[model samples]
Target chain A: MSEVYAARRERLRERCAASGSATALVSRPANVRYLAGAAPRGAVLLLGRGTDLMVCAGPLGAHPDDDRPDEALRIQTLPGAADGRGDPAVAAADLAVADGAESLAVEEHHLTVARHRAIRSVTPRLRLTDLGGAVEQLRVIKDEEEISCLRIGAEIADQALSELLESILVGRTERHLALELERRLVDHGADGPAFATSVGTGPNSGRRGHRPTDRRVEEGDFLSVCLGATYRGYRCEIGRTFVIGTSPADWQIELYDLVFAAQRAGREALIPGAEYRDVDRAARQVLDSAGYGHGLSPLTGHGVGLEIDEDPQLAPAAMGKLDTCVPVTVEPGVHLPGRGGVRIDDTLVVRPEADGGPELLTITTKELLAL
Target chain B: MSEVYAARRERLRERCAASGSATALVSRPANVRYLAGAAPRGAVLLLGRGTDLMVCAGPLGAHPDDDRPDEALRIQTLPGAADGRGDPAVAAADLAVADGAESLAVEEHHLTVARHRAIRSVTPRLRLTDLGGAVEQLRVIKDEEEISCLRIGAEIADQALSELLESILVGRTERHLALELERRLVDHGADGPAFATSVGTGPNSGRRGHRPTDRRVEEGDFLSVCLGATYRGYRCEIGRTFVIGTSPADWQIELYDLVFAAQRAGREALIPGAEYRDVDRAARQVLDSAGYGHGLSPLTGHGVGLEIDEDPQLAPAAMGKLDTCVPVTVEPGVHLPGRGGVRIDDTLVVRPEADGGPELLTITTKELLAL
Candidate 1:
């Protein structure tokens, strides 16, 4: 495990060196964790110096869940700086310059302008460069160990959703249902919900990323739920829409079937060599032809990893090809303004045809059930 | 209500004009909400232009909890930009430059380097100046209406904590307790927990800002819980420690009393015109004299409002003085490593001697109860 982190840091160092930077400071929490194996909040990893240092503001206490840094790397605790209060990025930059690094690359997309300016002021002689999305690109493809975490997270999400289905959901507010799902996710061994558990019902149904509200579940209304779990820092999403009564209305059934078909098409298009935009188009065209494309979500789906949303976005303007072992969500939904709507989503990993088509991690049935 | 937001924006405009900035863009979500009365995610409020516009990425959906923008302010929804996806800061900058604003101010401390660069590229001729926490300064002395929201939020938090005290707590894990508290917060009319609820048990107890873990409660263990609720965009925090068994150990009782005294001192120091450092000192001196100051937390407490952690931090190096109506938490804790510890926190509003030294919002008792 330690070697894995060391190798990741080596790869990042190679990338930085190729870009003419002698040192790279990873301030983004996820990026720091990817390279250092553990990212205590406000901890930063400075690479390419004689010894890769994980600069933290204070001692990592009895935090069982905090990722442990690679044992081989040196850890520097800045006691003068208050625990969890000072900016570790600025401290890391000062250390990098003091360690004789001439050029340092930082994530411009993550660091605020004020912090970046502070870094420049502290190291007037050191040249600063942008390390734009380089680490994010590296995180796109996952190893089997990473995939197993995702698989476990998906299973937890599935168990939670299944339990919600078995219980009484009628007359429950969207907020309560969402909270229950989150609690169930934790009960089933997830760190927490990968993101806010979204439970949209009645007029709120089928909306992409709709925040749970106080609206109650009612008969003949569409009830859509989207939730995910975080296991060992990996995240996976699953969304399903169900009718609230004994039988669905004609419009509800039609909307559910249309979304299911779009989601299936999107899932089927997840081949290793497929373009991201093409996969998005495969699902989006189904809804477009059905005349519900005008207010469609910006993206059909998005990549998921340590972060709930990452790269390789499945959108019309996305520029990239799907790679093997890249986990992504293929969610498509259509919501009519005053009426209800439908959404079906699943997390799957892109795989070669020789092994299998896209390997579905979130296997919760998409069948529109009348609860 | 609309006039209140308009008046706030006018005050900001005056501040920016004094600083030689003809126009100002508020990209920080809390600041945007403060000035515009609503901050749809990814929205920005541009002041000093003929019409102060709340530029949002898309139409505000049927989100009842979302703050309604001041009626006097015109809302410009860019339908082309996906909901909550586009950078309204860049759009606002483009608008400002096109409207012939020669100079514009922005919250450099909040904007990322990439975003600041994007704004510069889009408006090359516009002189970008640092807003420099001006809005935050304005927010420091909150109005009575804002204080009322905090008061309600504190009441909700107190209710949630009281309910938890009645439940059995001999064997529950910290994570479950934290989640239950959050569920209860929503049940009591909170939009949500202001921040992640912290429930540290036994050795993990009394740690400031400790993330909840899976450690279960045991007899004689110290249990510390910190939680808050967000009501109408205002947030408040309250923390307390209790003994798990019917009787506490001698050491536990002493630690609890010492922490209680310290917390009381800090709370009592929250009068108007009190230096922030003096307030912190009032708390620190109590624990320091008892030989437990070596590993004390950085700050005694901090302000809470639209955001859980805000300005006027009560730390040794802080430079501000408390003003009337400024609500802040005076939390003091001592963690003894392998053994447990105690923390007492309360949110109170500073007041003058004529009106009452300070107003306590959270009414949760400070008595160290042995459950």
Candidate 2:
């Protein structure tokens, strides 16, 4: 694990050196964790001329549940412990300047304007440059260990969803169902829900990011649930839409079939070199030709890893192509105003046709189940 | 309720006008919610020259659990549906400049350097000024309506804790306990958990922000739990320490008593006009004099409102005077290296001595109970 983190840092160092920066400062927690084995809250990773240090805001004492900092890197916790005073990013910049590093690269997108100004104030002579999404791009293709974590996370999500289906859920409220699913996810050894568990029922079903509510599951309403689990630091998402009662209405069946087919098309388009926009179009064109394009969400799918939403966005305006090991979600949905709607989502890793095509992480039945 | 949001916006307008800016842009979600009644994710509130518009990346769709936006205010979903392309703050600034406003005040601390540069690039003639923590200062002394929400949230938290106490807890993991508490919080009408629930057992106990893990309870172990509930957007927190066995060891009792005394002293110091450092010292000095100061947490308490952790931080270095109606959490804990320790926390509102001193929002029992 330590070697893996060190190798990741070395790769980031190469990117920084290519950009004329001798030091790289990672302040984003996920980025820091990606480069450093583990990042304590408020920890910043400074890869400088002297030594790599993970600067933290609080005491370095261990908490039972905390991910221990990699022993290969030095750990530094600041004094005074006041908020906004002892920023780790500034500490990193100062350390780099003291170590005689001429140029430092920082994630300008992650650090706030005030923090950026503070870093400049601390190291007046050190040249500051943007690292941009270099760390994010480096994280796009997962190593085997990273993929294993995502795989476990997806399995945990599946188990939680499966258990929810076996229970009597007709009279339960969306909030209760969501909470129960989250509890089951943890019971199945997940770190926690990858994001807030969303259970949308009735008129609220199929809406993207729809929060759970008190509305009870009715006999003829659409029931859509989107949930995920975090294993280690990796996250995977899965969404499914079902109908209430023993039989689905004609509209419900059509909407469910359309979304399921669209989501399947999006997942199938996940080739090693496919353009991101092409995958989005594969999913979106199906909905568009079906006259459900105007109110569609901006993107059909997105990359999921340490954060529920990451790079390699499958959107019409998105640039870049899917890499072989890139894991992304292919979620497509259509919501009809007061009548509810349908959404089908799955997490899959892009693979070449020679390697048996896209590898599906979340294996849950997407058939229109009238429960 | 709409009138309250309108009045809050009016106050901000007055401040901007006095500072020579005709309009203000609020980008922080909590700040937006403070002035616009409810904040949608990625929503920005613009106090235009002639009118106020709440700009969002998408339509003002309802969340399943969270509160809906106050319908009185005008809303504008951006022309393009893509999130990366639309900048509500910049759009608000452009609207102000187009409406013949010469200057715009924006939350500099909240806005990123890139976003600031982009706004400047688009509206070259418009003078941009910093609105540093002005809205936060305005939020310090909450109104009676806000207090009522906190009070209800506190009740929900109290109910959740009480229910947990009645359940069997000899062998449950910390993660399961935390999840159960959160489920109960929702069962009692919380919008959600105020923050991630913290449950620590044995060696993990008494740590601030301890992420719950798979540590099962054992006899003679110290168990510390910190939890809260958010009602309507107002958040209140409460933490308590307990002994797992029938009777606590002599050391556990002594530690719990010392921490309780320190917490009580801190609560007594929360009078209107009390110095923030003095309140922290009132809590700190007790633990310091008792020879348990080396591993104390950085702060004693902090203000809680629309956000769980907000302004008016009560720390040794914090410079501010507490005012009436300011809600804060005084959480003081001692974490021993090898053995677990104790932490006691509560949410209280600062009030005048004549008004019966500090009003406790979270009325959970602080007694050292041996479960």
Candidate 3:
């Protein structure tokens, strides 16, 4: 594992050298974790011309899930800096200059203007270049190990959701339901939820990133929930909408069927070389033709890995094509104001036709379940 | 409530006018929420010359926990824009210029250089000045209503921590304990945890912000737990440590005594008009004189309200004075390498000595409990 991280850093070093940068400072937490194997809070990794240093402000505590750094990387805890204070990015720049490096590349997007100014002030003679989203672009595709983590996370989410279905949920509040699902996720060995557990009920259901409220679930309410689990820093998502009673009404079944068909179309479109927009269109056109176009969310689904929402966004204006080994979610929903709606989401990995097209990670049944 | 938001915006307008800037762009989420009552994802509040507009890339849906915006402020949701594309800060600047504002103040510390350049390009006729934590400074010394929220959040945290202490915690993993505590926080009416829950056992105890792991509790292990709850947007913190066996060892007793004494001294020092450094020294010197100087966390405590860690930081070199009604956490701990340690933390409001200085919000017992 240490060798993998070191090799990734070496590849990044090679790219920087080709660009004429003497050194590189990785400030973004995910990127730092990708190349350094560990990302302690307020820690920065400096890929100097000779040695690599992980400068941290706080104690080098270990997370239960992630990989620890190998012995090759030097870990230096800075003096006098507290947890969440004293920008480590500036310290990296200062270290670069002290090492006699003439040029440095920083992640301009993540560093604020004030911190950038401070870095420049400390090393006035050093030339700074934009690293842009180089690390993010590097992380678009995943190794088999990374995919394994996401796969397990998806399974945990599936188990949690399935358990919630078997239990009685009609009278519970959205907040309690969300909390219970989160607890179940942990019980199933997930490090935590990929993001905040979203539980939207009735008119609130099927909304993107809906926060749970104290509103009780009524008999005819549309209870839509979107949740995911994080396993070893990798995240996967699953969303489903259900009716609160023994039998869903005609309108409820119709809405659920519409969303289910749209979600199926999106999943079917996930091929090795399919364009991201094409996948989105497969899902979005169904809802749009049904006259639910105006209030649609920006994206149908997004790539999921280290970050819950990553690149390869499935939207109308999004560019780029899906590749084998890339994991993504295809979620589509339509919400009718005053009334309610349905949302169905699943996490899948893009694969070749020879490999059964897309590998569905979240294997929960799409059939609407009534509590 | 709407009038209060409007009045806060009016005060900010007055400040901008005196600085010779006719408008201000608030890009920071907390700042936007402070003035506009609600800040949707990727939303920016523009205090225009004639009107205020929340510039967002999409329609503002109902957020789960945050308060909705006042009807007085106009919401301008952009159409056809890609999700997560187009900076709202730049859009706010363009709106300000279109509204015929001559100058604009931007949060330089929050906005990136790329967005700053785009803002400059869109409004070439306008002069941009640094807003520079101006909104954060305004947020300092919160109103009575805001303090009430913090008080309630503190109570929720207290309830969660107390419940965890009564459970059979001798053999549970640190990760499970942390998750259970967070679930209880929501059960007690917190929107969610103010921050991630931390549970440390054995050598990991007493460390500030220690991430919970899979380590199971053992006999004679010193178990320390820190947790918080966020009510509305107000956040408060509480931390306590306990002995695992029937009775604590002599080392555990001594360490707990030292930390308790330091935390009390820090709370007593939180008088109105007292220097921030004085309050930190009141607690820090106790730990320093005990020959545990080098490894202590930099700041004894920090202000807590809408944000867990806000202004009025109590540190050795920190500048500024403690103002009345500014709630803060006075947490001080020492961790031994091989042997475990103790950490005691609480939330208290700064008050005048004549009026019973420092109102404690976290009422959990500080005694070394043997579970």
> DockQ for model 2?
0.65
Worst lDDT run of 10 residues, candidate 2 chain A, spans A58-67
TM-score order, best first, reads: 1, 2, 3
Kindly list the per-residue Cα lDDT of model 2 for residues B152-228, writing each as its tens digit. Answer: 99999999999999999989999999999999999999989999999989988998888898989889999999999
The alpha-carbon lDDT assigned to residue A238 of candidate 3 equals 95
What residue pairs are clashing in model 2?
Answer: none
Task: Give the Cα error of residue A82 in candidate 1, in Å.
Answer: 2.8
In order of lDDT, best first, we have: 1, 2, 3
| TM-score for chain B considered on its own, for each of the candidates | 0.97, 0.97, 0.97
TM-score of chain A of 3: 0.96
Worst 10 residues of 3 chain B by lDDT: B58-67
On lDDT, the leading prediction is 1
Q: What DockQ does candidate 1 have relative to the true complex?
A: 0.68
DockQ of 3: 0.61
Name the best candidate (by TM-score): 1
Each model's number of backbone clashes?
A: 0, 0, 0
Candidate number with the higher lDDT (1 or 2): 1
Model 1 residue pairs with clashes: none
Which sections of candidate 1 miss by over 4 Å? A83-86, B83-86
What is the per-residue lDDT of model 3 for residues B1-371, given as tens digits with 9 covering 90 to 100? 88978988998888888888878999888888889887777788999777788887676665435567877999887775547667778778887877888888988898886787778887888888988887888888888899899999999999998888878988899889998999899989998999999999997888788878788999999999999999988899999989999988888899899999999899889889899999999999998899888878888999887788999789998899989888999999988976778899999998788888788999998888899
